[model samples]
Target: MPHDENSTAGRVATQERIETLEADTEIPAPDLDTRPPSSGATRQANDDLRSLEAGLDRLQTDPEHAPRAWQRFTTSVLPPILFVLALIAAWQLYVVIAQPRPDIVPGPLDVLAAMSQAWESGRLQTAVLTSLERGVVGFLIAVVVGTPLGLLLAEVKPLRRAVGPIISGLQVLPSVAWVPAAILWFGLTDATVYFVVLMGATPSIVNGLIAGVEQVPPQLRRVGTVLGAGRTRLATLVVLPAALPGYVAGLKQGWAFSWRSLMAAEIIAVGGTIGFGLGSMLQQSRELADIGGVLAAVLVILFIGILIELVFFAPLERRMLRRRGLLGGTR
Candidate 1:
């Protein structure tokens, strides 16, 4: 009886103490009428703030770093690659399906086989190297001759007025048109081919240079004058650099003309002395009645042209135009 009484009395005293503490703090007890929601509300707000911070971190970091390189490569480089593959595949398909006389359309496999055979026999490399050497040498000569001529045309108004139309017209003239005359002039020698190539290229290069000069801002010329640039110094430093892009364009056009002219001359005036260029190879294939060889030669011509354009002009043009801000960075 004494133990039970003491226990009951202690429980009453503990309850009274809890009631008194709750009253002093002005907070309801958990088991009583109600409890304050402040702690739960704070926890919820903290959770929301943490979630928002996490989201912002994700937004700022991930998109800029890893995928950009891949995106650029795919967007900039892949299309050309895919186009080339498609073109080759289409050519192969056409060759397979047409089943034309070998003289008319050679299969891709046949062309490749001939290429391989030519390589093994050492003739392909010899022919390619010979053609490349000729093209490069002829192109350099054209640049040397044409560039000065172009500058003259650009600076001298009377000369420009006299020859500007002719220069532009020369670009459209077929290189084949010069073959007969070139042969007549120089006969079967390489000099004849070189001469024709120079004739073919020179006009285009000159025109390009003239155009480039014309494009240079008049203010720049005024600036040069104020800086005490002499005629020669102005031409060399201010005008030439300003007109370089047009001059480069002329070179590209000139190369095309030179290549075509050489080919035409080689085909019409065949000789061992001419060596084996794409044109000579093509002529030989035609004479031999070998379609596969003809196709192979054609492919070689196209590939070489594209290679030279890409290697020399494309990048150079891009750089120049970009520097000038004329290209708008499309390349």
Candidate 2:
């Protein structure tokens, strides 16, 4: 009788504790023997990760191709074309409406007619060819002479400390200022023109080269040295190739300097046995009071500049940037 009474008391005490916990917290009791396996929890986590991986794979696979042809035409081609057309229209309108004195500003139609006249007589072609030949030859000479000098100046700290400021100073000096000195050095001939172009352009090209060479990664140089590359081999295989983009950029700027220098030389050093260039043509047009001819010649000069930049430098620059992956999605 005593053992039965003790057991009943213990059971009643346990039941009361359970009821108190459930009533106080409104919580259900957990089944201790029925917990989820660790592997099942891990499998759920992996399924979530797989879903995330699938999302990433889809993003990478989605294509972002180049613009469609019509889209390209609308965005790229149309704006410039429209701008040029608008400029032409405005010029024509100004001529038609205001009718500026013919000697000062010629009408568009008048300029067109003058262009046709020059073309038929073959003088226009000759002048263009002469100017273009001079510009190209002078630019090539600047590149040849300036590139090595620039490389030296950039790579050699002593050279840079000595001549870097001088180079930048030369860039600011007007190409026209070189004309008087060039004439004194080479006399009034193509030699004088070439000298002026060289003086004007070489500094810019050299500076560009120097900057490019300076920007080459030191880590790359170290890597080359570690790989047993000798001085010449390192420069050829590592430095030059690495610095090519900057070199090309310098070439573009050098060409602009050369063109300007040639124009200055042609205009100031006129009256010789040499044939007509665009600059000389413009000078003659002014003397003859032929504003139409002047405008035509100016347009031709602008066209030449655009032609060279678009045809040569633009593609070259794009290729260099592409090789470095800097321009991967840009086009």
Candidate 3:
């Protein structure tokens, strides 16, 4: 009886202790209706945070923050113009100093006169148009052929191992070296020029794409795979976008190679159904011993190259870099 009474008292004491602890630790429910308003400093801090967010958003989207049109012209266009002007001035100064023979090295003014005469006769326009047409067509063809070939080579290890070195070798080979073989294969025709252009440009494009693929981070590929992207999707959506810089560089190089090859083939092949191009004009001037005409033709070629780079490749690369946040500033 005594043991039972002691056990009951112990249980009662423990229960009372638990109830007291619970009462002491109890938290009252917050009454939303009676809650005090936020302090002035808290409201001010929130406003400041919102203002900061708005400022960041404006910085991202505001056109006023970008480089102005005049600024862009000054930074990009003015420098090249100044450089060309300085070069022309230097050439003129050298001519005045040395007074070289007109047949050997015509002055810039003589070359300009030749260009003006050709322009008046419409020969310059025709030659430039013809050459440009050939170069564009050949470059387009190379892009069509090389893109898939490069993708395949980049994806396939065995194929790349077998053919990669050969492509590199071809890139190093002079475009002029292909002229004789192309002429023999296709005759003195537009086909001969196109064939040489293809030979010169295709390797550069292929190698470029391969190089780009190699530069793609392995982690990116893994991420694509994790996202359940198929092989084609992974390449086109993920790899290609990431590899754009190298691919664009390759395209620039390919165009240069195609232009050089077209010139070589046009110069060497000469006759048949081939239209008179800048190369043909240059050759004709050489044959006639017209140094001014030769220099004018060369100048036209140089101008065309610079124009294409400025109009096409430069903007493309700049846009790509800007999109990737690689460029230093907005333009």
Candidate 4:
């Protein structure tokens, strides 16, 4: 009876102590719940944070550890120049050491002298300008025709199926093959020259553009369609941009064809003021057995092509690759 009474007292004492402790402890009132920011506000905050990070990154990298411009010049620019100089030096050494007949291979000095003479005589400038004018006109015509033709062939399955092989075959066909037919049809006129140039260049350009457009990611096309772009708009904005590298390649080839065609016309169709160019000079030099003059003319031809590639096409190609991220980040 006493043990049971003691157990009941202990239970009563424990309950009273718990109640007293609860009364002494103050319960915290809940804070009013705040509404979350709207999606627009959240997006803005994230954008701000990204901008902050970008700025910080830029500042951190303001002082570059490596000289990028110098490195690019050394690796990309200097090597080609050095290689070409070395080649020229080697050629000069061979000429001096061998003392080969000038008719077979003229020395560098002899070629330079011939170039200097031609420059003073104004023949070099005249021939260069004449050839360049023809090339420019021919290449422009090729571009005007080729771009749309390529797009059409790429877009229309039936057209591509019908004309694809012909275009490819035309590219493999030498520009010189057309010269005889062009001469027969147009008879030594600028028309003949233009016909040959167009025949040679248009096919290469069209093929390049077709390849580029066809290679455009299908995902991009679908995306463009989903974004409400019409076929024409999609081609102009999406497909063309994606196919820029190939398009550039086409333009480069078109220029080359135009040059080759012009040279052929100049060589074969001499006498008219219209037919006067470096090819004419070369022909004349060869006929007269002026080995130095022949070499000088050849050098001028090579130099012009190289100069055009460097000045116009090289920069354009580099920009396209860089924009596409092909040449930007570390490899």
Relative to the true structure, how large is the alpha-carbon lDDT of every model? 0.80, 0.83, 0.88, 0.84
**Clashing residue pairs in candidate 2, if any?**
none
What is the C-alpha lDDT profile of model 2 across 69-166, one tens digit per residue? 79867866799999999999999899899978987888888889999999999889998999999999988888889988887887789989999999
List model 3 lDDT by residue over 270-294, tens digit each: 9889999999999999999999999
Candidate 3 displacement at residue 116 in angstroms: 1.1
For candidate 2, give the lDDT of residue 168.
Answer: 94
State candidate 3's TM-score: 0.80
Candidate of highest lDDT: 3
* Candidate 4 runs further than 4 Å off: 1-67, 328-331
Residue 195, candidate 3: C-alpha displacement in angstroms: 0.2
TM-score of 4: 0.80
Across residues 180-204, which tens digit of lDDT does each residue of candidate 4 receive? 8877787878887888889889998
Model 4 has an lDDT value of: 0.84
The better-scoring model by lDDT among 1 and 3 is 3
Number of colliding residue pairs in model 3:
0
lDDT of 3: 0.88
RMSD of each: 22.4, 14.9, 9.5, 13.0
- Quote each prediction's TM-score: 0.74, 0.78, 0.80, 0.80
- Minimum summed lDDT over a 10-residue window in model 4 is located at 16-25
